[model samples]
Target: MKLSVVDTERCIGCQSCMFACSRLMGKAGLSRTCIRVRSAGGMERGFVVIVCRACEDPPCAKVCPSGALKAKKGKGVRVDLTKCIGCGNCQDACTIGAIFWDDEADKPMICIHCGYCIKYCPHGVLELAKLEAGHAKR
Candidate 1:
């Protein structure tokens, strides 16, 4: 499955997706979640949902000293926790600010494109799409 922001304007900043992401990872909070929803500026300014775009050529993988971040075509980076040195290089290399940190483990949290959180988005701000080759992502 492929994940994408369907409409940020429709978002209510409920953070249901964020919680769902953590739940899928066997957690109860944002600590382990790859998806993030943050207030853009003020409450009236709306919210921004930050998640991996599954870049065709992810820079995070290029700067990863341990090669822990591996880019997948039409999918996001696959993180190898064992190989990861917790150096935060991948986090820094992410231009979209999708890389989330695990404060307890000192590791980066990248999306696996499971689409587990999409179902919890009550307002349809996020969605899962078919991972078709050459298909332009929204």
Candidate 2:
């Protein structure tokens, strides 16, 4: 499966993804969202939806010393808080600024590609795609 960002031109900077991410973690606010949509230098440039692209070889996973980040089967990565040392290595390794920080937990928040936020995206900015049976060499 691939978690891809669709056309971002329609994004209105509503930040629904942020809320959805936080909600998935049972948070009532945006304090714990793995994804974040912030204004591009004052909102005139539109919005940028920040989230994991589920790279084939994720750099975040490589830099994580505590093994808090692990790739999931046919999907993105999941965080094991018990193993997280909060060294911020994953955050530094993320080139797209996808890994968000949970200040309270002192750990980086990441997308698991659950597709829950896709419903909240009114602009069709996000999508989850399933790979064909023989697409990737096993």
Candidate 3:
């Protein structure tokens, strides 16, 4: 399953999803979250929820010189932390800026599509969808 922003219009910019993601990492702040929600301009303009779309052929994984980021079929990339060299190549390769940095560890934080954050969204803005067989988005 992959996390989807089901209804961005329903989002109130409460950032519950972000908090939930961080909590999963046993942290008390936003620094550890793989997901981010920010205002497009201001609260009046709505917000943007940014997370990995689970690319079929993720550019981030392709650019990893250390083989830390491995592409997962029909999902996304998985990070082998021990192999990561803190090169920031994955962040540069992601066009959507979904890749988040852990400044303390100097490593990339990526979503595993665990759907833990979806339950915390008060507006039902997020969902975990099953990938259709043989379906691909370029």
Top-TM-score structure, candidate number: 3
Clashes of each: 0, 0, 0
Model 3 misplaced regions, further than 4 Å:
134-138
Off by over 4 Å in 1: 131-136
**Candidate 3 or 1, higher TM-score:** 3
Residue-wise C-alpha lDDT for candidate 1, range 34-59, written one tens digit per residue: 99888889969998889998877789
Backbone clashes in model 3, listed as residue pairs: none
Would you estimate the TM-scores of all the predictions? 0.93, 0.87, 0.94
Error of 1 at 102 (Å): 0.8
lDDT-based ranking = 3, 1, 2
lDDT of 3 by residue, 70-100 (tens): 9887677899999999999999999999999
Worst 10 contiguous positions by lDDT, candidate 3: 129-138
Cα lDDT, model 3, residue 90: 94
The sequence of per-residue lDDT tens digits that candidate 2 reaches over residues 20-90 is: 87998999888988787877777888877777877666788889998889976556678899999999999
Score residue 44 of candidate 3 by CA lDDT.
90
TM-score computed on alpha carbons, candidate 2:
0.87
